[model samples]
Target chain A: MISSDVIRGYNDTFLLSLLTKGDSYGYDLSRQIRELTDDAYIIKETTMYSAFARLKKNGYITSYPGTVTQGKKRTYYSITENGRNYLKEKRQEWRITKEVVDKLVGGDNK
Target chain B: MNTIREYIEQMFKGVPVTEETVQLKADILGNLEDKYTALKESGASEHEAIVTVIAEFGDIDELLEEFGVSRVNEQVTKNYETMSESDLRQYIQAKGKMGWNIGLGVLACLTGVAGLLLFLAFQSVLSGALYIGLLFLVGFSVIGIGLFIIEGMKAGELERFSSPYIILPGDKEQFISEQKDYKRSFIFSIVAGVSLCIMSITPILVGALTAVLPILVGVAFSLLLIGVGIIFFTYSGNIWSAYESIKHNGKYVEVIEKETVKHKRNKKVDYVIDEIYWPIIVVIYFVFSFTQGTWAWSWIIFILAGALESTIKSLAGSWDKD
Candidate 1:
């Protein structure tokens, strides 16, 4: 399992990327993230919620009450124009970050 | 699933209610339910699924802190640890005094009923001077109630200064034992109260036995009930002091302080209204009783006053909510 600390900074990027596709509620977003990562990283409920809060606060995403299921109403989040821009920037930043880390640690150990 | 929902609710019990917080709670619960369902479908046992889901959800405090919601338990635990021994002793003393004052107030209220009963039994035979003496007893009881209320209020003021001592999570066994003791005391108090009420009426049932015997027995029963009820009431009050001291701590203090600040203006209005309301109601009751001699129906005003007080309280509460 991937430690949260290693991927903390990019949690919002992952969430916003999913929202970029379509409006999704909490559980659906979490499920998609799990599927995408092949269960290597199961984002904690807390981390997921904190990401949503941060994204919404930064106007990177907007939320609305979705269709009620099993007597529970879900808050559906959709990415905004600002969110798309933010995600593009994060992707570029991650590319650079990964390249540097790979250069430092990817070579075979003695 | 219901257990999961209840557990989540318990975790957020002291969290401030706001639109964002409500949404956060709903979102968390939804995700937990999904995780639990997925685990169950993956051939996990019910227990395993629940345990896995909960374990993976992580600490609630971290989530609350992310939203800038202060952790009530952390504050409470800190307060408990830092409380000085002298302060704790002072708090315990104040709490004991408050309990005694409240107990006295209840006893004084009960004495008013005894005074009324005495007047009923002796009104036919007693001289006008003695009748007035009975009225004096009733008057004194009411004054006693008022004095105890003031004393209780003073004790409460003192209690506010001393930090409350909370039972820590590590002391789970002690907490459970205290809870059990509280339950036992609560039941004992109820039994004592009910028995006192029944015994007080026994004299009326035996009134047909003899006229003089009825008055004698009635007074005796009243005295016994008073003694027994006071003992039970005091015992329960002591138990409650223990319970509240362990339970409240810093979170309780913060909530109370917040409430007082929120309702400060309303409380002042309530006080003034209460002062005016009771006197007006009393005047109306007496006027009807003396002028039309409708003592039976005039008593309805007290019931109306009770209804009016609750209506005002609810109105104030809704206003605060808005």
Candidate 2:
């Protein structure tokens, strides 16, 4: 499993990407993130909610009262245009950071 | 479900109650409830599901920090403990007893007045009536004051639990429902008191008119009727207020809707009338006695005022909720 400290920087990116997939709620988004990471990661509930708060605060994501299922009222989140743009920038940032770190440590691994 | 709800409530406890914080709690509760339900459906036991859901909730401090709610603001939370179910029940019972004692004390004092009046009212019919009246006054007043002292001691014991606790998280629904259950009985007690107070005057007035009893005898019994009615009503009112005070405790108020908090606080102020109602009733008693020359009829107004006030508190608190 990926350590929370290692993945902390990209929490917003993963959430925004899921929002871009479709309007989704916190629990579902967290589940999707875990499955998509193939069990290597599971977003903390606080981390997910905090990211949602930050994204909504920054206008990167918008939320609304969504459907109730099994007696629970869910707040669904969808990515805004600004959120997609931010997600794109994060993707680029991750690629370059991955490249640099890999090059720096790649030789030691071999 | 309650575990999930309490996890969310505790996570946000000690923080200020604001729209943002409330929404934050709602959001967390919604997500956690969904997750817990899904986990349960997947063959996980309740304990296992709750553990998983809470584990994923991560550190409460993290969310608190994210929202910039620092440890310094936690003093309010530290001041209150979550009141358990048994504790609430016990406190309510104690409050009930205290209320009954206080009401009974008042009744005793009133009955003493009636006992004293009985001798004076029938002095023509009996010898040494005035002296017996004085004795009656001293004796019943002693009993009434004794009851007051005992009830006061009970209240002193209760003072420790009064302001320092709030409702336990999951108990909120049960609290509201129990309050609702008490509603019917409370109204019944109020009405019963009213009936008793009315009975205090009616029988003697009718008996005197029929020459079955002296008109003066009615005065003594009127006070007795009023006293018993006050006790009955006061008992239920006290229990109802205990539930109310518990509901409005600062910890319980944290997660309540913003309007509910407002209504509850308003109810607190609204109840200051409890202190002044007797004075108002006394004033009304005098006005009725002087204006209409009917002391017998006017005194029952105390019971009427009591019932009216309790009904208002009961209805207005709920009215604001709606």
Candidate 3:
């Protein structure tokens, strides 16, 4: 389980990383996150879209008209080079943070 | 499962939940259907399988929060969109500047009125310049009205309810920050007003000694400028009072994902000439004109008719639906 404050920042970064691979719709993205977390995490559609809004505003990613198999066209977002760089930076930062916290929490066990 | 769906819908009941949220719900249901399919393959009864899936799904509130939606689903009453952060800053700056202009203009109007009265009292010495002095009075009135009207028009264009720059929308902390900035500027204005009042003492006393009563004369002239400033600042009904007042008026326009604001009160452009201002201007013109015993009724009748026109306009606007 993740603390709510930390979770939001993580979710934003994770979404950016996923988009760096290719375009995906909201539902598919949420399911991918679930599978990645081994069912430990589930993101709501609202959070995903809100992050999408923030990312779009910051110029990290851009959206375009794309059609899915089902209904009307959906606004599919692709990661710009800027988004890819941001994801790389965030990944390094999160790794360092997780490593430091894990040491402190596991000091006695170690 | 139906109970869970009902619960989720009930939770989102009054919020302006966008179409995206509805589609998201359908996705969640699809996931639930998948879970139900897996449970049925294990040979459990259909109702029990549904219950198991519902139990596994946990709370939707946490899911909603993950998407940055407000959990405490109160209807957002003031939906003022279009007033972006930069626009808001511009509005505040414009209002402060308008206040300064009104204050200074009022001081000028007072000087003009006092100069006319004093010049008239010593009419024997400056008889040649009296017409020039009358010209100043008319000129001041025209300038005052012109500035007031322009400011009112600016105020009208300001977006009423939504502020775009505030990233974490509806945060009380941001609200407090805005209020503090407003209060600080408002106090600064009051201090400036005191200094202005002091500046008017010399001309006011000099005019009274020459014959026109000082306090009554001073107050009348002062209010004209103040009224003009208020109109200038509150011109578009975009001031702090406007924000509060419009809430009492309810959003006048329907809006969607992109924010839009509706004017609650009358949108009539009343030129910022209040009752107090007209009476004062008329009396000053009347005093100086009657002192000269020229045809003064024209000024008086004109002021009276203008006042009647504004009053009728205001009353007629009330006929709009509640």
> Which model scores highest in TM-score?
2
User: Poorest 10 consecutive residues of model 3 chain B by lDDT?
Assistant: B249-258
Give per-residue CA lDDT, model 3, range B1-322, as digits (tens).
Answer: 5665674566565433444455556555555555566668879887888776665555555655544444332334233232223444565566555655554554556556655654555566666667876887777767766666676676556544322211223322343466556665555554554444444454445545665555444434443443344333332323454334223332212332223222222443232344454666668776776687432123335436656866865665566434
Q: Please provide, for model 2 over A1-110, each residue's C-alpha lDDT reduced to its tens digit, 9 standing for 90 to 100.
A: 77899888889898888777789988888889878889789788888877887888799999888876777677888899999999999999989999998999786876
- Candidate 2 lDDT over B93-210, as tens digits, reads 9999888998989888988888888788789879999999989998989999999898877788776455535454446567778999999999999889878877887857765777
TM-score for candidate 1, residues paired by index: 0.45
- State how far residue B89 of model 2 sits from its true place (Å): 1.7
Kindly report which residue pairs in candidate 2 clash with one another. Answer: none
TM-score of chain A of each: 0.95, 0.93, 0.87
Model 3, DockQ value? 0.07
Q: What is the C-alpha local distance difference test score of candidate 1?
A: 0.68
Which candidate number maximizes DockQ?
1
2 or 3: which has the higher DockQ?
A: 2
List per-model TM-scores for chain B. 0.42, 0.63, 0.42
Candidate 1 regions off by >4 Å? B73-322
Point out where model 2 deviates above 4 Å. Answer: A1-110, B1-74, B156-164, B253-280, B283-293, B303-322
Could you tell me the TM-score of candidate 2? 0.50
lDDT of 1 by residue, B51-167 (tens): 888877877877876676654645443433333334445555665566666666656655655566665666668667456756756786777678676875686566443343332
By the lDDT metric, which is better: model 1 or model 2?
2
